[model samples]
Target: MKVNYTGFQASEVSPYLEVHQALKAADHRNGKPDVLAYTSVARMNPYQALLYRSFPDHGFAVAPLLKPFELRDLMLHKSRASSITLHLHWVNWVLAGEPDAQRAQTKVSGILGRIDRFKQLGGKLVWTAHNVYPHDAAHLEAELALQQGIADRSDVIHTMAASTTAALAEYTNVDAQKVLVAPHPHYRGAYEDVTSRAEARAVLGIDDDETVFLVFGALKEYKGLLRTLEAFDQLLDQDPSGRYRLLVAGGADDHPDVQEFISRGLLHDRVLMEPSKIPGSKAQYFLRAADAGLVTYTRSLNSGAALLYQSFGLPVLATDTPVLRETLPPHTALFLDANAAVDEYAAQLKALRALARSTTQTDVLDGIAHLDPSAVSSTFAQDLRSRLGLRQH
Candidate 1:
């Protein structure tokens, strides 16, 4: 049996092959796809999927880079590396969840070796610098080694913020010549935004007058979920009216402290805790219910979650990081000192009690139309094709 996938094809079904791979077994005539996006998302997550959505239109085949983090299979099939471009995004998967520095080094070393060999085979690589280090911020040596090695080899170091080059230069080697600044897409059309605010709040048991402060995305420490929780605790202690409702929802992490803190937060009447990945169909419920997005990232090169908030027309309460300041317009968000005290956080929350979003959803979208995913990805694909000297469609 044969099936077509996004105009790419599979001659026979194979569980191991990505959408780009055909299961004919012997004919390696068309091996791996032309563009492989390595990501932190699930195999078909919108983050990576939407990125290359315009690729097919631009005459390129795309697929998620499958596991084992090596190109040995391509080598085994005698595939030419010149035909492929590996796009890396938040590649902490190379750490393999090993906290120990020694084991971490071994894992990173293996992947680096494979990348080196891929380059040797005439492959070009594009690395999107999503973070300076992994969320846990562990194993400085191994992380730095991996990034420095990649920076030296990457044909383009893509980033969502202009500050990426300077921010990364503080800790790792960054060749400015290799840097390319692009926009992070707002998840406007990605989520099912079917529910109205009233209906969402009603289902979620939120009160009409209460202002919901949403802390979304995975509960990683680097994202400042714990700090957000701590401020909510202080806010509760100081205010009796409880107008500020804390809505913490997302895929929870396995870290003991994070799990414990979020667990404690669930007990509070003012706190609404989903503590799991919200289904795409239900993503709008939280966004529509909340008035302001809470981003307490201690460090970040860029934030898709922030863009996600603005996509739904909600303003954000974010740490005043350089990247956020540069990427987001001032009208779309209220900034907080990144290194402020818990008291300062509580005060900020107090100040936000009656705050209203200055910009409507339309205005938010209009301000950055140039950065819209459709345009940005199309430009990216066309530019990529030009860089490779591929024929223009």
Candidate 2:
């Protein structure tokens, strides 16, 4: 089958790379619903090349998609099968043009119309609910309208966490029956030449005895980076002689709060900040250097960072959200209320630091065996074939 996946490129920060790689791996063994990637451009990003280099024999192929106007023309003139076999659109990235309200509305309306038309032409529409709404939504109502329209039109609405199904239905009024819950796959062998924990810590200038807590991934307003900083500061105050360090790694957003925090000179010495896009080869260095990963999101539907941390057999200190609670095992992760006081968060950090000192890597992996990438990929392939009425080869 010719599956056209939108909002996917080889070098995206989202789950597209992992999901596609897993599906490609699975399809090699169990050939069902043969898939090909659809991109707007021909060139692969450097990071994409790094990730795909090892899978040289992987059967996936990348082809260009019809341009916006060309897509409209095809929907009007061509048969559904000729136009495309299956359309799998992801996240709010596909719903572009947000600043100009009129333009955004027109684009959204056109896309929704195309979705309806695509279905009418016997093509399938799949929308993966990466978030309840766009994180950087400029035009709120227009974005929500587009989400609702997509939810209303999609043949299948995919969410990583089961808890997100009800939240998505509530937000977009999508039917519960239309939602398919599939857990995000683990990052087993995504990176190359990963650094050892000791080597990583040494290179980062962290001492062997220092307890490092990492806030990995893109630093955004909703991620509670400031709160994590506050809690870490309080922890330092409480234990003046403690060897605790904070590693805030990943891209920094243009949010005023984030910029303000950066300008305050808080990230120095013990607080190391790498405000850049971490390459796939260097991802393991960050993960290995830290004793535990922090997910202090003020709000979230699901956190891919948490899964990445867990996949490395690293313990996580996460804010208590319904989605995190549902997805992470209680024994492996330490959770606190989203609105917990700084002192309370400080205490939890102290506790996690002590726990991390004694916890073995194997202990962290014991409870999350189901998050294995192979299992997740098989499930994803099976679900797609089942929903699209395609036979398993």
Candidate 3:
């Protein structure tokens, strides 16, 4: 069976690749299906995945849409595979942040148009609902309407989180039978096999004495960076001479409030910003060197950041939220109320600082070992096989 994954190419470093790789390996081992991941011409250009075209496992099936209209004539004349399942990852930019009516209408229309075309071509459709988009109050109506349209046309609606599944059902008025809950792929990285804390610290340029609090990934509003900073301020008050420093490794995209807070001395030298994207290897080093990983996301269905932290054997201090709790073990993580006042934040911070010192000996390594890529691959292969009605050994 040839399964073509639509939206975003597989070569780039993304969570989607993790999923694709897992499924691919599982399918190969179990003899479940032959996967042909479809991607756009733009992604396959010499400037992109084409550079890696020699690598057969990269999964670069040329997508017809991105080609020039005249050039598409060539693709049309070629022998096309008729029996293929089209899995479209529901990806419309800005669907979750601030929903503009015009954009929402356009995005929905575009998605529906694509779905209609795939249907006409006799392709089985699976729309994975990664997000409903426009997470705020303003976009609620528009998002619901768009979701309804998607649900009506989609043969199967996929969701990684139960909360996301429920939202889809409620917004689309889709029957519970149509929604399929599946585990998103676990991260596979070189960081999993790392040795010592000293080596990890040396790689990231931090002293052995510093108690590092790591906040990884791009700064987003709901990620709770503001709350974490406020909490850090409180933490500092309790331990004025503390050696703890925050290492924030991510690309910054014009976060004015975060800058203002830094300038106002609220964060001071405690906040160390690496205002660039660190590649996969270095990211692992930073996490391993940290005393505790911080994730204060206010509203989240799931987090890849939390998984990365756990993969590197670093415990997390997250906000008291369902998503974080579900992803991490309660005993291994520290949680504080998302709406805590400054005083409350300070107390929690103080406690967290102390806890980090006392619990340094805790064996979190064993816990991280469970999120294995091979295990995740096997699980995903079995699920996809079951859904597609294919026999697997």
Instruction: Give the best candidate by lDDT.
Output: 1
**Best of the candidates, TM-score:** 1
RMSD of every prediction: 4.2, 6.3, 7.4
Report lDDT (CA) for all predictions.
Answer: 0.72, 0.67, 0.55
Per-residue alpha-carbon lDDT of candidate 2 for residues 1-393, written as tens digits (9 for 90 to 100): 796354344333222343334344443443332342232232312322222232213332222342432333323222211223333444355555466888878878887787677668655566677777888887777788888887787777777787887766556887777777777665656555467889998888888888889888887898877777888888888897998899877878899988875655254556987877787778878888889999878877777788778878788988787788898878779998889898999999998987787777788787677876656655665675566565544
Per-prediction TM-score to the true structure, in the order listed:
0.87, 0.81, 0.72
lDDT (tens digit, per residue) of candidate 1 on 1-393: 674452223223321354234223122344333544343445324776667667766655554455536454444323422255667777777875686989888887888899888778766688888887766657778888988888888888888788878888877888887777767766778889889999999999998999889887788767777777788889888986767788888887788777876878888778899988877888889999988788867777688888888888777777887888987777767778878899898888866654544457676666556666787888778877666555564
**Which segments of model 2 are wrong by more than 4 Å?**
1-89, 94-97, 265-267
lDDT of 3 at 194: 58
Off by over 4 Å in 1: 1-16, 19-45, 75-82, 237-239, 357-359, 387-393
lDDT of 3 by residue, 1-393 (tens): 776464343333333343345343432432333332332233211222322222123222223222211211222312332223444443333254544777766665765676566557555555566544533434556666666766777666666655665544434576566667654433544344454789977876679998788888776666667677777777777787877777787755556755653444333667776756666556656777788777766665556666666666567777775545665766567887777686776676666666667654335545545545555444544554456544433
Deviation of model 1 at 74, angstroms:
3.3
lDDT of 1 at 232: 81
Model 2 / residue 217 / CA error / Å = 0.9
Give candidate 2's total backbone clashes. Answer: 0
TM-score (C-alpha, index-matched) for candidate 3: 0.72
